[model samples]
Every structure is written in C-alpha cells, then in structure tokens.
Target: MTTQTPAVRLRGITKSFGSNLVVEPLDLEIGRNEFFSILGPSGCGKTTLMRMITGFETPTGGSVELDGKTVDRVSTRERDLNMLFQSYALFPHLSVYENVAFELRVRKTAKAELDTRVREALALVRMEEFAARKPAELSGGQRQRVALARAVVGRPAVVLLDEPLGALDQKLRKEMQFELKRLQREVGITFIYVTHDQEEALTMSDRIAVMSRGRVLQVASPIEIYDAPTSRFVAGFIGSCNLIDAVVESGRVVVPGLGAVPATLPDGTADGARVVVAVRPERMTLSDQPIEGGFAGVIAERVFLGDEWTYHVKAGETELTVRVPSGETSTALAGLPEGGRVWAAWPAAAGRVLPADETASPLIGSPA
Candidate 1:
C-alpha cells in the first residue's frame, strides 16, 4: 500500500479471444487510494479489463504493472489484491468474524493480531455486532458488509468490486452506496469498482472511466463525465439526455426540425456535417411568455413527479420534456393543456452538440 508509483498501471494492454478483440490496447494509471470505477454496458469488456488488472486474465499483448513492476506473469493468488464477486461468495458455515479472519489464518498470523484486525474490519463496515452471525442468518446488506470485511481484513493493496450492490434491492442498494464510500475512506485502500449502473457509478466513485466497444471513451470525475461526455456514445449511455440532430453552419449548430441553437462543436466540424445536441430534462424550463434564448413548443402531456411537474412538449416532430418546480406548475403552464402552445427554454450552457444520426431519438413521442 505504501508506494510513490501508481497502485496499478496498464500500458498498451490488449486482449483477444481467437479473432475477436475483447479489450483494445489501452493505457490507464490508477493513483494510490483513489476510488476509481470502470463502467460500461454488457459485452463492453469492463470485466475483462478488471480481470487483467487482478492477474486472473492474461493480456494477449502489452503488460500490467503493479507498483511500477510488471506482473503480467504473476499468479492471481500471489498478487496483493482482493476481489469481491457479484455473488457475496461467503462461506455459509463460518461466522462473520471467522470469515473475516480466515485470510489471516491462511498466512498464520498471530492470534492476538488476527482478532484485532478482524474486529477493526467489522467495525469499519459497521458490522461488528453481527460478527458472530453466519452468512445465511444475515440480511443482504449485512452479508455484503461481511464480504467487504473479509476482503479488507488482510489489508490488500487494492480491492476490486464487481457490482457488489447488484444483488440488493433498490432501497438497500442506495443505502450500501454511501456505506461503501464511507468504508473506502476509513480503510484508505484503492478501490477499482466495475459496474454497468450509471447512477451507482456517479454516486460512489471519485472518477469514472466510461467505456464502449472495448475501448475507453472518457475518463473524468462524475460531474465532468456527465456534463462533458467526449462522444455521442458516452453522452447517451451515462444518463438521460435529449439528443437532437443538428448540423454545424459556420460556427453555430442549426437543428433541422427545431431551428438553430447555440452549442459547442469539436474542431474541424464541417459546415453542413450532421451533428447532435444533447440537453438534460432538468436543465429545461417551460413558460407561456416569450423568454430570451429559448425554444418554443406545444404542451402534449403532463405528469406529476413528487417535487416537480413534468410537461412533455412538441417542437415540430421532436418532443422534449421540461421539469418545473411543484409550486410553480400552475403559473408556469398558465392553464396550458394538451395541444396548447408553450415555450421550452434553457441557457446555452445546458446543451452540448456532437456527431448525430438516427440513434438520437426522443424519449417522448414526437408530435405528428
């Protein structure tokens, strides 16, 4: 755990299965004590990359360095790492304390030192009182804590988690999100978490590496990843974004169906080349009166969300959703009903333009 070099580094790493490439040559540097996550959809090779880091899978090309030393030839067991599977993988017969202490016993640590470490690990996850309970008798969250305790008890240099919260219910999963973050800070160990859940990645990690098609798309903090996705794939996959097809005319983006809207374009974008503008629902506002720099639409439907009222509006053939504060719904809509004319507006900073195609469809059905 003590090192000046990165905890893990993958330089020009590539892996293939026969003719199909699972992971393209990619370079990544993970800092010491950094809670990093590798996120992507199924078949995107997130798991394969994590396996290579833990020494469970060999790279067909390139190499993996741990603490500045190449460990591509090392065995999984010999690496100073611990991995918690999606399945808790706890021993049913062993008590939580025994499960946490099992690793110490394997290395023949002293009895006094083993007990002290086990208790500390259990307390770190707030599961010290349930130390005597077996995995079968504990709740999902409790069992998850036990698994975490077991992984951290041996003080591994890095802990790899493969969707540890995927097994829990929605409420329990949300609760465990904070719990895991707290545990990471308390133990001060580097955590490399892999998951396809976007919300989970945004909620827990210090930084996220968004991947697709076996390549890393963008690596940044949660805010940057969501606000400034490097490509169309990252924008659409990370969260809910209203992607409108547009084209760059001069320097501004001219959306065909919705007219020209201010947007940021990448360098060397052709004047008539097709592009897309991504706008989040939360960034939009609905009103009856004309506002500065806002698009006009017709109200098509309305839904009541707990703290806000969502109005689906049609801008030509495209439909957009706008969320207004619960208290301002009546004033905002001004008695507008289905088919009533209105305006959906937001600042220039709210939208980002990118390369677009048929994939940028509206969440709400477009007006006929």
Candidate 2:
C-alpha cells in the first residue's frame, strides 16, 4: 500500500503564556481529504491548537507543516488556509455575493472570474438563491451558509472550523451537521474542526482526537474510541460509562460487591495490580428473573428518554445506570416500581480494563 503525505503535520508543538502551558509538546498528522475533529471540554486547548495551525497564535516550540512544507514562518494570508468562526464574521453591509467574492477580489482576480467563483461557492453551500440578501436580513443558518461560502470561495487546501455550528439551535445544528459532512466530501479538502460537543464530533469526523489538559489522550475512529478507550478520562469524557474500580487477580477484574468479571487486561499487567473496568450503560441487560452471573439491585429511579428507558439501579453501596431499549417486550418493565428488584447482566467481553493511573490528575478545566 502506498502512504500519502499528511495534509497537516504538527511536530513537537508547544504553547505557553507566562509559565502557564496551554498546549504541551505534541505531534499530530491529518490525512488529506480527511474530516478530523479535535474534541474536548472548554479550556482544554482545542481552540489554542486551531489558532496555532491558522497562524493566529505562534507556538513557543516546534513547527507546523502543510502538504510536506514548513509553514511556521508563513504569514496567515500567505498560507492557503481558510477559517470559519462561530460568529460567522460576515460583512453586515455587503450582500452574500459580495461577501463570497471578497477573498477573490483581494487576490486581484478578474471580475468575471470572481463572479463565477462566488456563484459556484454559493451554490455549493445551497445559498446561491440568497446571493442578493445582506447578512443582517438573513437568519442564523443562512448567515452560516454565507460564511461557509466565503471560506471556500478561494478554494483553499484546508478549512479550519472553530465551532461553526455553535450559534444555531439544536434542530438547525443537527441539520447543518449533515450539510457540513456532505460539503467536506464534495470539496475533497482537509477539514480540521474544533468543538466541545462529543456527539457532533462522532457524527462528522472520519477520525477523532480526544484532548485533555493540553494533551491528546487518544486518536481513533468513533467506534474504537468509544468501545475501547485507552484511559479512564477518554472513556468517561466520550460518553456515559460506568467506571468501576477493580483489582486484577487470576486474569479477571475483581469489583467490590460485584465479584470477578471476565476482562482482558493489557499485556504485562501484573497480578494484584489495580485497574479500572469500563462498561457502557447500554451494554447491560435488566430483568426481573433471578439469573446466574448477574448483580442484584433495586431500581432507584427510571427516566423515559423517548427511545430508551434509563434505570438507576443500586446494588450494595454502588449505584449503576442501565439503559433498556424501548419496545413492546421491554415496555412491560416500565410499570415496575422504583423499588422493584432486578438483575443486571452483560457479556464478559463488554467490560474493558484500563490503567488506573489515568485517574491521578483531575481533568483540566474541570470545575473545582
């Protein structure tokens, strides 16, 4: 197989401001025509990394490369990159056509060529019919489309989106997610997106990099990141997971009041070593029948979440959240009182063992 050069590469990148390190030394490679997302909570340095790539912030150490060329010394305007901001940043006085043509005009392109590119860009974003409308007269979604048109009008090799859909409501944001993914595939350009929304990242990214405390914890596809996370932080941050403290003994994880659950430990894991067992709530099954190899618990609460039912089950001193899909057969359990007794069971392979050291430091930017 042939290896393609990365569209963007960061080598030992580091950023600091007066002894406060916002971005630690890190290396990353983004493939060409890839929709990659940098995901984390606020103040986790995702935005800072985007700024460094866009030449808005200079790294204290290391370099930034694009298409195999070092771009650390290149001015932001000289680099072939475009950025879409959360606020849209459109010109209130200009019409959509003029806004989309702004970049081409600044580059001294001929008027005829500028008009052609502007119309094409607008059409690409499905906003060509609104070309005559000003930014002030358009809705939030329309303004976003105009901003997208302007970013791609110059046909840059890379587009940096820093929470581009943040301003829209939930319904509009969901609609734009599909639009953005389709646009990325059609343009065939590298997209580096930064956002704190986990579901959004999983929905749009070809691959995701989970960052914390200015450091990347893991980089993988959505399924791999969720199903087999590398650390406690990644497991807990990416989705709702039950992280039970356990000890490794006889090749199994021993959970307090839960007995030993079959698990695959990492290579070189020693007997009697402490580890954490991660299990997704949906992977568990709840039943009223007494079953072998199951933990007995009482349903403390139940919540109806449209498509699924969430039950807070208390076993011994630990509380576990279990999710049961909504269906004719499962709906029978809906009437089960909160104090009803139930058993929760899951496949032996559902549990994943992670290094216990991951919990040593509090998550960066977490509330005190």
Instruction: Give the Cα lDDT of each candidate.
Output: 0.85, 0.87
lDDT per residue, candidate 2, 1-368, as tens digits?
97988999999999999899999899999999999999999999999999999999999999999989999999999888999999999999999999999988889999989988998898889998899999999999999999998988898889999999999999999999999999999889899999999989999999999999898888889888888788888889988998888898876778888888756666666778788878899998888877688889999998988888898999776688888888732544777899999888777778778877773432222111
For candidate 2, the per-residue lDDT at 172 reads 97
TM-score of candidate 2 versus the correct structure, residues matched by position: 0.95
In order, how many clashes per candidate?
0, 0
TM-score of each: 0.93, 0.95
- Which sections of candidate 1 miss by over 4 Å? 1-3, 266-268, 332-335, 357-368
> Model 2's lDDT to the true fold?
0.87
- The prediction achieving the highest TM-score against the true structure is 2
Relative to the true structure, candidate 1 reaches a TM of 0.93
Cα lDDT, model 2, residue 217: 82
lDDT score for residue 168 of model 1: 97
Q: Judge candidate 1 at residue 313 and give its lDDT.
A: 88
